[model samples]
Target: MARGKEYGYLLDGLNSERAEMIKRALRAIPEIKSISIRPSQGTIQLIATKDPETQVKIACEVAGCVFRLKLGRGQLA
Candidate 1:
């Protein structure tokens, strides 16, 4: 069976540059399966195999950004 989980995050106070940095940071971790970002809404939607909260926290720290847990439409899968 597939054991993957999805998570959505809403990043505040981020521009294109900051979003890029965060993407790189998250991609560096193997646990992060996929990453999607919306610059207009500052939303980062991710698919992770495990421990998404920790992974996102570290990525945000590395990127010097802050985020909140906000699930968008159809993001709970």
Candidate 2:
């Protein structure tokens, strides 16, 4: 392991109003080792024990927000 593999997301429709809910949803998952969200940049950074896309998708749904993923190449890691 190289410390941790950072997985990132370019949020399609994130705004201040929905940030808290999404952050809260992310926090519910224990495998996520790190989290950083920049509402202004419309991006989210995460490091987890495993791939987090599925959990992220679920969180977005639970928060009732629509999103589009960035490069099919995957997140920032």
- The 10-residue segment with the lowest total lDDT in model 1: 68-77
> Against the true structure, whose TM-score is highest?
2
Cα lDDT of model 1 by residue, 1-77, tens digit: 44567678777777788889888888888778888888788788787787577777776777777866667657543
lDDT of 2 by residue, 1-77 (tens): 44565777777678876777888888888788888877787777887877788888887787766666743444453
TM-score attained by model 2? 0.78
TM-score of 1: 0.76
- Candidate 1 lDDT at 40 equals 84
Candidate 1: global Cα-lDDT? 0.76
**Model 2, position 6: C-alpha lDDT score:** 72
